[model samples]
Target: MNVLKRDMQLLKNSNDVVLARQKVRQWATELKFSLVDQTKLVTAASELARNALDHGKGGEMTMELLVNGSKSGLRLIFEDQGPGIADIQQALKDGFTTGNGMGLGLGGSKRLVNEFSIESEVGKGTKITVIRWK
Candidate 1:
């Protein structure tokens, strides 16, 4: 895979989440993603960014424009160094939440993208990667 561009932003607050959404939308538009596709990617990015901030205490988001043969995709990586999840399966289940959220962030994000993967350790951190193909 070849990365055309890469950008990283800090997810420290609610404003940062908004900025992350704007950045994702901008990259999706640059890649000529359709309106619906762009919305899906942006929504997923927002949720992940918020998770990094709220649940993880703070983290970072990385956006990459990728090219592989005839396929082009936007990939997002969210990483946080906080008290990590103890049960990823339960966290991924819809309607399961450790906070005040409705518990759709992880599962909903997965449904919005073409690819999704998550890794977390009990006391280490969490990293979630998602890709939206065009």
Candidate 2:
């Protein structure tokens, strides 16, 4: 297989977050991902989308369909120009949050995906990428 498709969705507000989740689920299902895989990917997309809105102020998410030989996968990249994470290690720890809500977004999303990575600059922004293979 090869790269099937790529899409970009802006996460400027709450509604975009919801749409992002729906799009991720649709893409997962279109690729014939298992129910469990679809759920995991969708859940992770929601968390990241919300983080982009609440923490990053606003951002965009890019979804990609990847294929290699007989295997295929979904990749999502969330980026924001808001104040970047000050401490990435601390942020990745479960139960660590700067807001009122429970701090499960980053770590939990990572756990739900087959691959996870994050990068941030204090005054710049943050970028989180996650991928799930099928």
Candidate 3:
């Protein structure tokens, strides 16, 4: 895979989450993604960004324009250095949440993208990567 472009943003507060969504939308638009695709990516970005800020205690988001074979895609990586998730499987299950949410962030974000992955250490942190191909 070749990364055509890359950018990073700090997820420090709610404003940063909005900014992250805007940035994702801009990138998706630049890639000529459809309106529905743009909305899906932006929504996923918002959920992951909020998770980074609220559950991970503020983190960073990296956006990448990727080219693999003849396909182009947008990739998002969210990382945070806070108490990590203990049970990834349970977390990925719908209606499972440690916070006071409707419990659809992680699972819903996964459905919005073409690829999704997550890594976490109990006492270290968590990292989530998602990709949407166009």
Best by lDDT: 3
Angstrom error at residue 92, model 1: 0.7
In candidate 3, how many Å is residue 82 off?
0.9
| Global Cα lDDT for candidate 2 | 0.94
Clash statistics: count for each candidate: 0, 0, 0
Q: Write the per-residue lDDT of candidate 3 for residues 2-83, one digit (tens) a residue.
A: 9999999999999999999999999999999999999999999999999999999999999999999999999999999999
Give per-residue CA lDDT, model 2, range 1-134, as digits (tens): 46689999999989999999999999999999999999999999999999999989999999999988888999999999989999998998999999987998899999999999999998799999999999
Please report, as a residue range, the 10-residue window in candidate 1 with the lowest summed lDDT.
Answer: 10-19
lDDT of 1 by residue, 1-134 (tens): 99999999999999999999999999999999999999999999999999999999999999999999999999999999999999999999999999999999899999999999999998999999999999
Winner of 2 and 3 under TM-score: 3
Off by over 4 Å in 2: none
TM-score of each: 0.98, 0.96, 0.98
- lDDT measured at residue 128 in model 2 versus the true structure, 0 to 100: 98
lDDT of 3 at 25: 96
